[model samples]
Target: MSETPAASVSRRRLLARSGAVGAGIAFSGALTEVFAGTAAARGLGDRGYGPLVPDPNGLLDLPKGFRYRVLSREGDPLRSGEGRVPSNHDGMAAFGGRHGRVHLVRNHENRPTAAIRVPPVEGLTYDPAGAGGCTALTLDADGAVRSERVAIAGTAVNCAGGPTPWGTWLTCEETEDKAGTNGYTKDHGFVFETDPVDPRRTGAVPLTAMGRFQHEAIAVDPRSGAVYETEDAFQRPFGLFYRFLPDRPLGGTGSLRAGGRLQAMRVPGLPDLSSVQEPGARFGGVEWVDVPDPLAAGTPIRLQDFGPRGITHAQKLEGCYWGGRSVYFVSSYARSAEGSAADHFGQIWRYDPAGRWLTLVVVFGPDTGVQLPGESPDNICLAPSGGLMVCEDGGGAQHVYGVTRRGEVYALARNRQNPGTEEEPEWGEFAGVTFSPDGSTMYVNCYTPGTTFAVTGPWAGQPGR
Candidate 1:
């Protein structure tokens, strides 16, 4: 797969407003101030409903017809003899097999500075590179892995990913591969495509065109061949949203692992989009812009209408996915201008290409009163009833919360693992969630104890009351 450079696009010109605005281009401070006065002018109401805010003191909980169970846990031995799960297991994906089993592509978000290194043939261990990466596991659909192999040769810190209709996983490396002597490993940040079934048959192609920034989660539009992505920001500058458009579009055999154009989110005309006032201030009035020359032929459109002043910067935006007609994502860190908690809640936003919309679907802060900053809303899954399942990375304990279509928040399952027990509980303290294809079964992974869960029950569909 390392034969040559990607097939390059010849030129760049004005492409029609292909329905949804391309990416969230950066907005300038000047335009932000201007739009602040009229931020409410644009109609952002048609797309989505609000977020689900719930209480904390409560442990495992949910609304109705919903239930959860543990599938995999830390220290659990594998049939393949690969190894046990590491300290922090952050993200995962599921694949269907012809023989009643499911193939899962999971990530272990371990720290480079700590934790035990895994062995070969079964699991993976990094030498000095970044401390997170992916593993291929074959499960029995009952949520059991028959075998697991660390596919890619030297991948580190693999976070969230988007699945391909052609049947592949695009695992993103979050740590920037900035060598320049100060480099941690070998410039470890780039998207790699892998086969969930055949880990050894995988390919590691750095999407050089996608730019080399810290990548969080990636969601792709199978029909449009457009890939939507999010950045996970900790204490650094606010992470920006992005898009990668391939020349030929998605589908076919080997098309996904190759070339394309990458563009960062910029509210055109608005300078230095990084500098924003508060979390919910609302840049709702800003127009989307394109990045000029970005990574390839797809030059940024550069819209100058939306200003930066009214926009809310996501100090931490981790999870993102393209479900139905909208590109949806979650923000882990939310702050206020006074440095307090801005509404103090983490938020979820939906972006539509055709209708050109970005709606804040849910806000989980104000209700919990747990404004401890970046505690809730880790990875998320879209359930059947227009509901969302959220993982909490908060204080004292970790659990999964169920959000209803009516924006009602409830706890579905709590962590059974506590300080005293040597026996890890049913729900792993760490949370990573993925729903089965039919949406009947919900699979969750614990980040703390490194466990996997499968939740099943009578699930009610959307259009909630």
Candidate 2:
């Protein structure tokens, strides 16, 4: 992705202001003040797409000159003449399609009892009893959905996942449902690949070698095709970051089922590193330990094996995206209530493959109620303007936040969809924030009410672009 000159300058200024160019400084209250001040100084709040204009339909709030159109909604009829679109739309990926259009492979984070389910087809169902799966949508140049159909079916809790370099979506099951348990014939916690190009061409196949746990999201290294996964188990045992080194490179005709080695991340000096001191905290010289059993036998892989080994644990490791040769991930709201070392508003970590080090980038402070530009970032994607657009999954009104390369933060869009009274707008978290290949439109999903929207505007002037 290319960056515009203005965005390049903003990012350069951000690095200098945040001291990211320096060895690394602990991001604390003082640093937060500096960041806020820098945002004000650059008039970031007023620039880059300007303020959001409320939607008359009371669905989405976007900046001036920008407008959103609802692409698909829950309970909408499927083009396949099957069941309606499943609820709880989560992670999604955009792929270039025929006739200068885009195809979106979207996950439906439903369970066995979901009101609607992705219609199951022979050979595509992982567990006939499970209901969660993915749906593929083809969008025209105007961001209107042309066709929609089930991409994968019979999975469970199809949460956040990453796209592969070779044009495929890795849909991850976020449940540890065991075989012969809860009416499930097969184990649930696994990753399945779905091709948006032709949903019917590929069957849902579980990549069991990736390790079975409460999987959250994944990012693939385009160079080596190494898959990095994050676990979102939120308990005393928490979750660990994992790396899957495939026996062979994973693009082209590569298959994850061909088998790979799964390993857990371990920071040498920071054993059981749950209490991250502050954002910008750098842990270098990291190591990875082999996971004996990638497939969970009787217990979840992280708890039974990696947890006992003192693998560095994080609280609710959610959305992860690959950009700038690094994997940026989110830890949503680490606090005493969540059994974390410290009470944090949220944390964003960056893992540098070249340096083999993980560094804390942005940290939301302990003030949970504070309505800053962004907090509790969940699904993330790189902006065409060279920054990050983070989806908020926390309390209060949710928004999609834009972070300049220089670290200046601003709200890109806010959820104005309210089923209740206007005094108490029912805010739902945004997920699956992705940009079209040509950067003309951005797509995102509202978790509740289950809606997908296509947003278009003067994206080039946006802070992250």
Candidate 3:
């Protein structure tokens, strides 16, 4: 399925308002100053709600008048009696439920060696040997957990996934571990669909057509039912951004299992996304190359041959979300010292499916300074107020940032809880960062020690909205 000519025309008009095509396209002033590749963009300044106030509880630090509550912890027993909560909480999505409640499906990026595993549930277990999976949480109107259960079990490294327009979660496994590599099991590294409302509807099946690799996150286009995915491979060959066109478009539940065609993105003249340094640099005539072997029986998709014009690849393609008729994906830093083509802290790209155009919306200059607002944005989501909420996965200190449409950056929350000593403080990276349908509360996760938080404040009164 493809977008209509009217949609393409609409996108062209939007681009005209932002800036014309190519290397000097000005964005909505949402990233101009912050991504100017200057020393000032690397410094910490007041931009969002205000300066973050330190939390006395030694957990999450937030701005004045804003507060967060711990909804789930690593060792807590699930209300559904599905065993203790798993560790290494990662990607997540929120949905509206009965009686104004919120339903959240969260991924557990667990390796086989992790102490606590997502308890295998009947009919929902994919492989008994795999330890990583997903858990669904039901919260009441006041943002308190009412019930929690295992949504999908026996998957490996369930890193991140996207919520479907049909009200389900596409959980992704971030591993290529073979059956015998770890233990008794099956081949991992595939996408699995989970139903937040009913576990029986999930069926614990893997969407093989989505391709097998170091899958990170995905964003689905509601109009065309196209799935855009990201791969978080950190090796020499790196990862390729993928698009999956399902046989069934917008078919409600259990439709992905019917099969689909998978393809990797190819930018005409660019091979590596990190090679481009200028903000607002746009690449036109984008193409998609079919992946011959979606199952990856022999070679990984990124290392496969896509004719003489090879597919484009990036170092760490992390967060992805759909908004304003475009697919926004992130590359969480690259370095020449680390064998990359060039160096940069982070990059946020906007892909217009209608026009087949890719634009660099934000780029964090590689200065190695921890104070930068755009430092290593991992999981991202579009706010109701036309801003971007960024979860930082970088060093020194961790924070959840809010970038206004005018390009101003502000600290919404900071991770004050460190698991290590002061000399070697290890603050876990913030993941998830989603909001309720009513736009009232924001939800996020701490990757290490496994904790979920519900934040509520004067979101309506927040400045720069």
Query: How many collisions per candidate?
Result: 54, 4, 2
Put down candidate 1 lDDT per residue, 1-465, tens digits, no spaces.
000112101000110121111211111122111112221122122112222233243233433444555555556665466666544566787777776777777776544542633333322222345455666677675665567656543455666776777777877766554443233555655677777877555555555666555567888876698888776644334566778887767654357546676655544333332233333333333343344443322321122122343223355667887666657777764544323234333566666677654554455533323311123477877655345667765443455665544444545555655543555322334455776765667777766556666777645433222
| Candidate 2: tens digits of C-alpha lDDT, residues 371-424 | 343445678776665456778765446789776545545567988776556775
Which candidate wins on lDDT? Answer: 3
Overall lDDT per candidate, in order of appearance: 0.53, 0.74, 0.81
Q: lDDT tens string, model 3, 121-191? A: 99999999989999999999878898999999999999889999999999999888878988947899999
Which scores greater on TM-score, model 1 or model 2?
A: 2
* TM-score against native, each model: 0.71, 0.86, 0.89
Candidate achieving the largest TM-score: 3
Model 3, TM vs. native: 0.89
| Window of ten residues with lowest summed lDDT in model 1 | 7-16
Order of quality (lDDT):
3, 2, 1
Cα RMSD for predicted model 1: 12.5
